[model samples]
Target: MLTILDKYILKRYLATFVTMLAMFVPIGIIVDVSEKINFMIENKVPFLKIAVYYYHFTIYFANNLFPIFLFLSIIWFTSKLANNTEIIAILSSGISFTRFLRPYIIGATLVSIFVLIMGFFVVPVSSEGFNNFRYTYLRTNGQQAMRGDNTDVYRQINDTDFLYVNSYNASSKTAFNFSLEKFDKDKMVSKITASRIQWNPADSTYTMYDYKKRTVGALGDVIVREPEKKTKFGFELEDLTPVIYIAETLTLDKLTAFIDKERARGSSNINIYMVVLYKKFSVPISAFILTIIAVSVSAMKRRGGMGMNLTIGIAIAFGFVFFDKVFGVIAEKTTFSPFIAVWFPNFIFGILAIFLLRNAKR
Candidate 1:
């Protein structure tokens, strides 16, 4: 059931959130545009269109960063209420202090759900447009890759059948490098290494350079062979997409898909993808947890008052960020489960929220 208080609080939070967004986004645009003003003028870009670009860019930046403003808004508005004795008045009216939290929880939950949806589905679609705009006109040249010159990556060419490298070239495909490792059941059965690999576009077959092939028979006998001619090998582009995407950029589905893709490809870089996917889910939930923690920390009026709450909130945000960052570094070096690595900070702070909520009640 919706209550009048819920409406009041929601209105207040959204109003303030939007105002802060309105101010901060324009400032960001002004700063960015100032640096590129000469570039725009040199291109003879019309002033009006330039202003429109800034407006769109600002909206995009502001939308991406809205949750942080939402958090701060709730904290600032609630803190103001407590400082002015408004929250105390509400609580002293024989309503349980916990009950006084209903409106806040409702508001937070609604916003959190909306933000999560926007983050997962909506934002990625928007990114295509945003990124395209940036690259097409704004000269984001680093988006493209150079063959043979970029970092080398390995990928499965197809269902346990072959492996490939599109371009080991950090610079050019001429000096390509790739390898194939065969596994039977849980055991490594054979291996092949190549110095330079070439892709055949018409035939969809890969060519190996300075390559050696080895085969392990069922009974453990090993055979090695070398051929002077470029042999047509079965391989496809799907195998290389994961590596290219990873080397290029990572998004939600892209990062998650890379986990399975890498394992299938027999690449050892699974840890990085694991961390990314875990953090995607974990970061949003932490925002919800932080809101709860803030409510608990700032509920009551005391000598420390709102300033105490602000300091504590800032400290807690920092600590949570620190915890997440440190855990991530450890997760990278060690074999820690990705979920635990990413979610532990949220778990720790959720406990802190519960503790503070109890104390605030007393």
Candidate 2:
């Protein structure tokens, strides 16, 4: 059921996309290596590890930039067809314009599915390794590799329980000025304070030094003091203090669970997590949208030829990235909804795609 035109268009579409990815990814890696070669040398990082790191980096970078490349590839190939008068010849053979678009839609669908899989499952794992290597080798001293704005952390363990830590050292698994409070309805029931708390990973418990506990009753209050106490708390070390890249490191299911847990804990930066979650799906959907826009914009021969189409495509690509970043920052900084911030660019571009496609058809 496949026509010659369909095969030709589909083959060119996929071939151009892969060729673009192949060409640019090495340039990206070379530039990155040039920038970080000195750091790797100073840190005495092994050559094998550096090579492996760039392997993961390639996946991470390509996945993030696939849409831009996809857009450009479509514009390049379609412009070539237009310049060679293949489009006119096909239409003259009695093919409808809508029929001519079938192969493009099919190619877009394929790319979108691939992107969805990578974004949901593959990119998170690669991103974890990529970020770890960059943080370990590229950063100087006094800069914390973990993600957080403050040392002091406050969290709600549950509706009736709350926790506080004045400062936490993630490497040492230690906290200073730790406190836990429990309330029965609106009345305070018990409070525990410690000068220091340390996590014992072997037993999965925390040891509190110079600890004091106060229990309140209707009649009076009782105080218990100890030099050190070991106990199990409801929260883990990550629950107490999560790194900034935690959201980026989780798969879809884990990310959803994390967001639910953070929301219960009254986390203020839930929007940031929401943005990452939504973007996984939005980025793939944008591929289909951008493909339509690219095909439409470049399918007709122009006075300026392929160069003109590329210039327009690049401008549109940058604009799309700019909108995505601006809206993401607005959502993270202000109270804008992360869902809207993530998908608004797609919505705007979808309209543009329709408008351009209609004009191209006419």
Candidate 3:
């Protein structure tokens, strides 16, 4: 399962990764502290909390940069080996480039696995702490647990026919215009429109005042009368939190749920949400593909030294970033599928990796 060359390459790469992390962590902390220093001082934030937030921010940044690290590490290690003619010696010994690639691929696989597991699984668990730490420390604190106001956007929270107001003003929570739409077997059964909605913290039910109602028939007709007022929608208020969570920040499952809810209500424009969902998964995997491409490009040091490879690496990284954003903007604005937008960069680079790897044989 483990070859000597593989172990050597891994050891080299691991040393590079550790060096990068060692240098990066303190730099990361300093940069984060600098960025947030004024906010913390102004907000009277505690030192301990600021320290924790810095760690969280560093983790997020490192996770994002993992692919670049993979690329650079492989490039530097392989380039040094190539400079010393070590790779030539290995090749002269009858080791094909394909055989050499085994170790690199294995190392990349392990890194990719580690990155994915941490990004999707671990970071989310710590997001609450990280975000709260920042929010608490920042000089300007936004309103939390918004109590009330009039005229708010409502989300049909779940399949149970409950709606959540995005932000209700405390001044007049009662007159807020939010409602719950009830459906049965793909037919609109009843609509509760509220002028003012108030959440009962004791029991979690929302009471709407000065509201109205409408019932629709199965055969595309009105089943019953005009809207009514003072309707108390009996559902848990906190169930609406997921709906109110902003589009980009929502996790995969929450976003899927939101999408389903919106679709059921015949929402036509969901391109932005669709783009977010696609980007979430594609962003991490892009690292793997980009890493492969970077290694392939640098491994053949027939011409320039490390400087040339570094320049090439930076260019490729920016190209990936640029195209990724362009596709997202296009997909969000047009009818282009989000899946295409998200995966296009990866596909292009993956092809590049294959081509470069083939050409870079010693």
Q: Residue by residue across 1-362, what tens digits does model 1's lDDT show?
A: 76776678667766776777777787888787787665555556566656656655664576556645666666777888888888888777787877777777776776667666665665544544443333324422332222332344565444555565434322122324567777766676777777766656666666666677778777665755554336565444434433422422345666567567667766555666677566656766766687777777766666987787778777776777788889987776688876788889989988988888888899
Please estimate how well model 3 matches the true structure, expressed as its whole-model Cα lDDT. 0.64
Query: Model 3: how far is 298 from its true place, Å?
Result: 1.3
Instruction: Residues 71-144, candidate 3: write the lDDT tens digits.
Output: 66667777788778888788889988888777776666777677666644565545544544543345345543
Instruction: Indicate the residue-level lDDT of 113 in model 1.
Output: 74
lDDT tens string, model 2, 1-362? 77888899999999999999999999999999898877787778888879879999999999878888999999999999999999999988999888999999899888989988888888889887786676556544534334344346777788899888875654467877899999989999999999989999999999999999999988999999999999998887765554456688788998899999989777787898999999999998998899889988998999999999999999999899899989998998889999999999999999999999999989
Best by lDDT: 2
Q: Rate the local accuracy (lDDT) of all candidates.
A: 0.63, 0.86, 0.64
RMSD of each: 7.4, 4.1, 6.9
lDDT of prediction 2: 0.86
| Pairwise lDDT winner, candidates 1 and 3 | 3
Positional deviation of 308 in candidate 2, in angstroms?
0.4
Ranking by TM-score: 2, 3, 1
Selected candidate, larger TM-score, 1 vs 2:
2
